[model samples]
Target: MEALNQPLQVELGPLRERMGIGDLLRYERLAGIPLRRRFFVALTGVLLLAIAMLVALVWLDRTGILAQAPVLGIFAVGYAVLAAVGFVWYAIDLTRRARLALFAWVNGWAYADSLEGTRRPGSAFARTLRSRERGVVASDDERLPFELGRNFSIGTRDWGATVQRPFAFVELPLPVKVPHIVLKNRRRSIIPTLGLGRGGARMELEGEFAKHFLLLVPEGYQQDALYIFTPDLMARVIDLGAGAEIELVEDRLYVYLPGGTRFDRPATMEATLRLAEEFQRRFAARTELYRDDQAGDLAARAGVAIGLRGQRLAGSGVSLMAVAATAGVLLLSAGVTAFSLFGGDLLRAWGAG
Candidate 1:
């Protein structure tokens, strides 16, 4: 899908926040019935609230507790201001969706009004921890510019309660096959909950990068992890991230934003995309092309269970002590065979004695 070629700041921004019927005509022409439907829905809600207010005013008048037309006029004016605020908010929300839809189209990306039925199966966004999940959130994901997706409520284990992290993510596919790693800004939160916490080993990198973030990587892959996160890359990550976490799980490198995608102003969106693009560009040569043959049952091979001395030989299926003992027996048997053949002269000497 592609958004129509329009200057977003010069054209789209003003037209949206503008409150003239002329702008509605433009919106109606572009969006047709959808824009109108939203307006009517908001209008209906305000109308009902107005009716309730009117009834209250009539009740007050009949009771003679408060008599004045002037008092009611002032209250009506205040209510109108409140109603305008509500209407403006509703209009802005609707217009933004329309803008985003068009924006996606212009950029040669697909756009969906919501994430439901659009979410790819087995995607990270589709999985959630039940207790932390927030139900059915509004989502608008576009494929163009980047694989940017938002799942309304990404659940987290926050302070022993289920917290909704309405997250927006830009997926960066790395050229190299790197183990899952997470780099979270230490200054942002005391606990790196959204980085999925410290799952394996927490690594502190060298230089200013180390000062800003705590890196977590899988066991035995510390060197490989370091290779991927070079000082330059780390610097770029820090420079680009607007204080969000960078999570690398398998091939998918996710730049996780704190709030819903819609909450991002245009500037934030631009910065995020810019950062993701830069990272992708720097790592393009290193990225390995995906193939089904490359897949392996790595989990089946990792060690499990506690061991006495066995921990030393884990994942090898045999103990180091067993190998040593077996070698010792083999050497002894070979010596005995040599002695049997060579002892003939020794036996005769012993008989003479």
Candidate 2:
């Protein structure tokens, strides 16, 4: 029993050590501090402004110089503006830093590489496997191995909120052939596209066909290929009468055709349309409505606007109240000075009469 336990213990020790190392590396790589730092910095700015305002109010009260209403009013407005600017600046800085932090985390080892950069494999089947490996390649229950190459294209359009900028459009193009594709409306705002490569042959488009055609190329494929396309605006691509040839290996998908084939068949067109619809649905369900970076930007902008507006309003209200107080103090001071200089003489004359 003792001998058997010793072997088990030895095996467990190495495994534990490897796990610890991996855990440590992960923490180091993904740990973030930007958000916390920004919060503290913004807080500090507010505190400092508050302190300065308190000191100024106290000094003016004690010196009996609060009688100057006009001068005090100007100072109050200046302070309000200054505080508003500071708050806005802090919010923008915080948002920018937060975005950087998010980018680091998403692109870290925890997430797989972007599909856009994956290379296709030399053999048809191998290309598929490479694509799977490059993306978060998986199905419902099991992790899918790299298989045939696939292409993904994403696009977006923004309807302007204000009148100045009415609309925005963006487009992204993909080079590899994709089978199973996903399309998502990152903002739940626009639709995206996914395209498959024409077989192993490359073709150029001409005339009216050229306007709707997109060039699909096979390059830099190793093992298997997966293509990911993210677009910024509305764009569509037609198959251009080309069909993609793919081979499956080791439960992976690969593109066998060196170049995509041209397909002018009715069947191919129907298949392509079906494939596109499937991808669109898959992506719509899976894609997140808002990305971390975009969320941060929106939050930051809102926070800054709110903070600045609130600060300005508060400061203005306080200054106005102070002005009224100062005005009362000045009137009291003048009355007291006049009484001291003339009251006794006036009382003596009234008594004699």
Candidate 3:
């Protein structure tokens, strides 16, 4: 709490020197962070040089070096453009990561350039073909162990578009595993892209709370969700997290914000901290003693366990609206085609131009 009161401190002078490609690679290797294709970049540079040399040799060996001048020039120009783009991309990525890493260092928080295969329990963490978390800031404080990062994932066919979707998230660890509960903010279009699909039962809260949030909980676990999301907590969520989507699965609570939430800004980071703290404090007590009676003897053995059904939302990740939209597109196209063919035939039969 004291740290949050203090201004966000970042020392970039020393970090600037280490932003070089070699230094960044060393840092990544030592930190056990994913390389993000650093080695591939180096390999590509060498391969490009080799290809250029080969092209030069072959062209020089031919009798009409002058005749091939245009072709060689084109190759060289393309090669230069490609190399320049790669270099620029590499520099930007490394600089972004280094600054975030420095921010973590000054504040005594853990940082990762890239994180994958987390296998965290949440609708957000469901099966993904390509998934990664970058620029991650994590706190080891047992009082409110949490992680803030930008996550990108490409879901499967049932999961919607294979296009990678990016979102910023703050995840807090819960004391016990609980049923899946999701709060979809009614205000954001990105919330629907979470691919929560039509899973679970849509729960409507009393009063104006229903206007801001659409709650989803496992079919029979409505009581559990209501218990956790009491009136007071719901109010806090509406006030602090009206723009973010909230999901609780197993033993983790994830607050998903828009992808553009910039951790690089002090205000943004502070706001995220406050949001995480509030949610953690409120949720911890409500979930600490929670045990699934449906777990039977397993609850006794594991101390805290959720039943298989409640462990995950039964609905597939595909949303009904997405299905409806796709169907509508197909129907529209079919209708257009039918009208074009039949309308033209009708005109011909009536001898109308």
Candidate 4:
């Protein structure tokens, strides 16, 4: 915790310095094989495009067409320029990722440019498919472990559209498994689409907390949630979490920020670290000794266990408003089609008569 208070060493000056071929290779290795392959693929495409452009220019010059149509030459040059620009942009992004990884290493944190196939216990992790995390910074401290990252979940919506939505999350693993509880940020309108839908019992807290968050827990776990989310804890969560959505599932607490926060920014990283530290400290204390009394026999056993029903929220994957909107759109489309077909025919008949 003392290390977190010290000035964060996030200067970009060293990263901005010109990198040698050896430096590039080192960074590529640090970035991992997946990202390295991506860089090579992009480089190959750029090289091939440049070669093709050169060949075309040579052919045009030999045919004397360059003299006849200067505009054609200009267009070819433009295409090559655009391809070069794209290549440069991709290269810069790769370098930025490498720098971020290095920074994490220097600060004793684990870094991953791509979190494809990596598994973590969370409610959002369970439902989402084709999960991918980028620019993840994980604390190496076993005492205060947490991960701050941006992830996008790929899944088909009810309308059969394949959608990929991005979100920023802070994942903190707890000591004991607790009943699933989701504290949905009411201010951010996007959480419903990305979150575990809406069927679980909506828990409205007393006072101003209700306006800030709509707490959701499994049918019988309302009291359990209340037990964990004491007034002081709720106040701390509201103050630190801001508009971020919170969910306690399995043995982890996930705080998700809407619209995906950037991990590249220094200020953002510091703030995220602070939030994670405080959240882990406060929430973990509340839940560390929590043994779901509803677990009965399991509670009677040596280890802690949540009740079967309390283990997961019985919520629909789609929100009520989303369902209503889809239905409305379908009905409106049907009405329009019916009017266009039958009403047009009736108008024509009347006109003829």
Q: Which stretches of candidate 3 lie over 4 Å from their true place?
A: 1-93, 157-164, 189-199, 297-304, 319-352
Taking the candidates one at a time, how many backbone clashes does each contain?
10, 53, 0, 0
RMSD of 1: 24.7
lDDT (10s digit) by residue, model 1, range 1-353: 24533322211342224344454445445544464355766787788877877777778778774465658755865796698788988677656655555555554445554444434221234333431211111213322234665555332333222233455666666554445556766766321244342235678888787778877655555665676677877777777773777766545576766554452255655665567657666655344532222123452244222112211111111223334565789899998998899888788999999
For every candidate in turn, the CA RMSD to the true structure comes to 24.7, 26.2, 6.3, 5.4
lDDT per residue, candidate 4, 172-194, as tens digits? 98888989888877777444433
What TM-score goes with each of the models? 0.59, 0.23, 0.70, 0.75
Q: Which whole-number lDDT from 0 to 100 does residue 317 have in model 4? A: 45
Which structure is stronger by lDDT: 1 or 3? 3
Error of 3 at 268 (Å): 0.6
Model 1, residue 231: distance off in Å is: 0.5
Off by over 4 Å in 2: 1-37, 77-173, 176-353
Give the alpha-carbon lDDT of every model. Answer: 0.53, 0.32, 0.74, 0.74
Q: Candidate 1, residue 36: CA error in Å?
A: 11
lDDT of 4: 0.74
Tell me which residue pairs clash in candidate 4: none
